[model samples]
Target: MHNTALQSWGDSFRAFVHPRVITMLFMGLSAGIPILLIFSTLSIWLREAGVERSTVTYFSWAALGYSFKFVWAPLIDRLPFPVLYGLLGRRRSWLIIAQTGIIGAILWMGFTDPAQNLTMMAFAAVALGFASATQDIVIDAYRIEAADADLQAMMSSAYIGGYRIGMIVAGAGALTIAGLFEAEGSYEPMAWTVAYGCMALAMGIGVITTLIIGEPTVTRTDSKYFHETSDYVRFLLMFALTVIAFIAANIYTANLTNPLKSGLIDAGMISELAGFIAGTLKLAISVAAAILTAWLTTKVGVTPTGMVQETYIAPVKDFIDRYGKAAIVVLTLIGVYRIADIVMGVMANVFYTDLGFSKEEIATVSKTFGLFMTIAGSFLGGLLSVRYGVVRILFLGALLSAITNILFAIMAHLGPNTMMFAGVIAADNLSGGLATAAFIAYLSGLTNISFTAMQYAIFSSIMTLFPKILAGFSGTVVDSVGYSWFFIGTAIIGIPVLFLVVLAGRMMQINADKQAEIETKT
Candidate 1:
């Protein structure tokens, strides 16, 4: 009887371990590692090493990787890499390039000393961020394209599970290294090197996974027509645009020179770094304009007519029919959640320190406690999605996310009692996890096999842009207004999302009715 029970359990576990799901897990890890390295973890390491707080805060700009992913998204969407394309096909070729860059950048990070070569470190971090962002675009596309509509929920659940696990390793593990490196008053470099090395190795899992995973079959219908065009024309247009944009960007670089160089000089708010900030902005604008031009080519063709006509042939115009309602809800919730979290994040450590909580206490409660809560939320959300349907669960998760942001505001006003802090962190993280899982599942369901990679990349990229732009000024806001108001504002920001959620739910209802009407007519 014991043997039979054990066998049954093993069988059940095996049934859930689909190869596509396993691939998503590794891809998620690859996607997640560089995120912390470039943003939070990098900030922590710099501050600990006696870098200026402002410089550490400013380095947050490197996260433009997540925001500007839409810029190169078209390339991954349409352009085949010359060397890798022949071997791995269009999708997997870019995946291999991105994964390799991620590993290389991490290794470079391990070798550099912030104290000696902070400029190089910033560049390296940007490289890692870009590679990571690129990897995310391809992996998201693959996960969507590789699976059927029904299987997408499970794939998303597995992907989030992997991403959360990666976060644990990066966040908790890096801090543990920092703590271990601390002796008396300072840190030893060994801990950072080891931590970075491990991250590089972890990224390698993506490189290996790319080799094993099958490329999605890309029919002409699958790839937008913009992809089939001459590479020389695309390259020439991009080059011409790059020249015009670089001139404006150079002015920004000139302004930021002092601030960028300040940690090495003195930390008196080097007014010079303003130029660099401006340059980043200019470059961002140029990249956006170029990417938009590339993306526009797809909609100009008669293929859209074919898709419209073909709609009459299938059961409800094929499962690939746009789920515009779900898309809006998912994107809105994503925008709100990230904006709330990030807008709060820049000031969070400063708030804790101000409240007289020691670094060790903050680390223990926030990182450790938040981790488990998030995990619980993710697991529960996955189970709920499979049981209750992704759309319903997504709506509930978004509502919960809004509720918890309010809870966080209350906690912020109440002061830093350990128990209350832990409570807020738990609630916030759980809601975040639930929303993340649900949102991923919802996005996955909307992707059609054709245009799978490009459309999914576009959606994922869309979701990141607003939050990232808003988060850039989080520090400026907190510095100007103070903490309590900041938290309250963050919480209130969720109100818009609640309305978006209701709108999305109604839209989904309309779509379902329309789909049903079409089905009956056929």
Candidate 2:
């Protein structure tokens, strides 16, 4: 008999050659580019433009869009486009809408000079973030529904590979291009604008993929609409409510800021009653607005004449019913699992920049080589997950992610050596890749096929939201404690996650074994 190893290799290779798999790879690139733009790529641009580190850190909140995606994910799940849905089906129609919005927003970001118009830049970033998050919701649902289990593993691998490649191009490639422009006698501010403009053009790849691909037919519990035109009404309600909230907030904040408010309330402190009043009233209005939005949308989205179940409601209830109180454990662990890596990530590029590593060096080492390491690690994690279980891999990933922070702490003292940087980069990227793979597999397992978009969106949103919150403070930590201690603290924070991961793993395995035994008996 031929070697077993060669047979396994052959089978794995065959998984990569599918046409749909190839398309996922391209789409992965599309999905990956926008994030780095809002996260690291934008940070680099900000640093180049003499933007303050704290400001840049806060700016990362643009990615809060990813966290809030669950807010509108239901509409994406069930609502059809007015005209586009008839042409492209549900997934592709939403994909097109998201893509168009992303492209326009990125272009808008490019046109606004951050050095001159930081407020407008932040607004553009928010717009880009929302659009990117929307695209992600649809894209994720597409991948989950595209194929069966084996193919999903294959597709996920391809997607990660493509995503890593996109990260490299956006991170390293963009930096290098900007560096070239800098050498060509261009100012840093202008150079970054050009870089972002090109990044927007890169979105065309996703747009074309949307046009050519076939949308997967989703099976929904509700085949009946509230009315013949109820979806349209619900859509209008969401849109109108959103517009009103924005206008109201804008008008209120404008009024508060202008009344000769003594220089915008001194950086971070709110000394004036007007400022405080506006903030409190805004928060109250937002709550009332959410309640109103729910009531109105429920009326429009659900049947008025008979007993009706809404798309968003049942999926959540299904999740809660399945997990009971254990759902808290799952969600909390997910929220914390990536915090060590993600929190450090906000300051990572800043660290490299401060450490006196040139953009070119960072591109070459931290990004280009880092991409390959992450992809390799991700593929390995995916395989291990299939062979063993997501729980084991998940626990291992959490442990390793925490430990890797120690390596960064060491590097903090070691200082600017390419050799050590390469070594640490390899370990860090590998562990992060493994964790990401395991996490995705776990999330995929959690989703109900009928409500994949809503459930997965919920999972993905919580996954990022907590870490983004903690990461928002990373700049403050570094500023106060310095990078070395900040990194050490980051490492220390992972201890709680390690325990949570182990606990969740044990609980999930026990449940799985019990279910297996029940099935066997049946």
Candidate 3:
């Protein structure tokens, strides 16, 4: 029986390498490229153009759109786009809109000068970020939904592969272009325009993807069929609650809602009442979830039985009951990898400048080599995960990422050698690319399709949260400790993560055992 299960595992791994799975690698690149252009790449450009360091630092706040994307995730989940929705369906519709917005934002920035219209540029960039975040939400949902349970990991790998490619084009490619134009110090227009043009070209991949990849089948909605009875009842109940809340507030404030509205024509109490209701709803949902988890566990031996055979076997959920630690390993490793990268990233440009590398020089070598390394790393990592297994690939990826950080530390200490700098950037991006694909595949294995968007968002957000916080202080850290020590500190931060990965490995084995036991019992 154990041998049979092993055979099944082997077959599953083999099946993952199919052509459908292969396509996701490029899709990942498509999703990834424009992100840095609007954010990190933009930051470097601003800093180079004599924008105040303080202002460059504050511009990071524009990323709030990403952190808060869960707010509009439901809208993307439920609301269809106007004209585009009819043609591309919900998933593709949202993707096209967001991608179009990203292109427009980039083009606008190409034409504007931060020195003359920094405020306008800032607004345009925020719009890009917001659009990018929306695109991510939809792209994630589409990827998860497009494949069956058996294929999600492949999709994840593909997305990462594509994403790394995009990053290379946007990050390193942009830098290289900037160098070409910025050589004479009179090439700001050319540099910025080239950077923006790369984004425009990168969006072509997404457009092609939109054209080629068929939309996932959606549950058809009747526009007005549910409105008469069930919808009206729900509306009335909601309306009743609103009225009662308003009355209660008015009574508490001695009829302030009416008097204020009459005197100042101000809309009163609605916002406060909405907040109160929202809090109550959140609390109620939490309680219901707790109750449901307890009830389900009791019925299913505290570990669910039966695989949810959809697009792919959700490795995360499948192992959650049987191999608890394996799930932790995947999450912790992903978090550590990203956090380490983010911590070092914010300080990288400043480090280059301080080390006497001009913006042009930094852009030329870093982007050209770094982009290719990242793409190679992601592609190879995905190949490895498919050829080997998640655990092995993860172990290798974590080790590579940790070692690469040390490489950067070495480069920092070695002083200003462009070749050495290129080497460090290449290694760093390579590890980053590999780790990203592996991590996404690992995370995808854990999700249930029903909660695909929400779960992925949760994982992606948690991973982003700490790293972003640490990154926020990257400038300050570099300012205080200098570059060499800062890179070394970032390297050291990976130690706990490495330990956590080992712990996760043990958990995966335990999960495998538990799963075997269930198979026997059934």
List the candidate 2 regions with Cα displacement exceeding 4 Å.
1-14, 18-20, 36-64, 104-127, 150-154, 171-183, 187-201, 246-288, 296-309, 350-363, 473-488, 509-522
- For model 3, the stretches where C-alpha displacement exceeds 4 angstroms are 1-26, 40-59, 78-90, 100-121, 148-158, 164-204, 217-334, 356-358, 472-486, 512-522
Clashing pairs in 1: 222-450, 222-451, 252-275, 252-279, 255-275, 256-273, 256-275, 256-276, 259-273
lDDT winner: 2
What TM value does model 3 have? Answer: 0.66
TM-score per prediction, in order, is 0.75, 0.78, 0.66
> How does candidate 2 fare on TM-score?
0.78
Residues 373-466, candidate 2, lDDT per residue (tens digit)?
9998887776665555566677788888888988888888877999999998899999988888878867877777777888999888788767
Q: State the lDDT of candidate 1 residue by residue for 1-522, as single tens digits.
A: 001112233332442477887788777777777788887888878877788998888787777767656545655655668777889888889988888888898888878889888998888888888788888888888887786654566567677777777877777777676667667578666678888888887777878888888887545454323344464354435534544554455455555543455543355542334534544555666556544443443245423433223222232233335564455564565556456655666667777788778888887887777777876787566656665566666767767766676665566577768898888888878887777777787767665665555556656766666765676666777767877677778777766765665676677677777878989999
On TM-score, the leading prediction is 2
In model 1, how large is the Cα lDDT of residue 43? 82
lDDT of 3 by residue, 331-443 (tens): 66556656677788777777788778987887776766676777677766666666566556666776777678778777777778988988888888888877777777766
lDDT of 2 at 190: 61
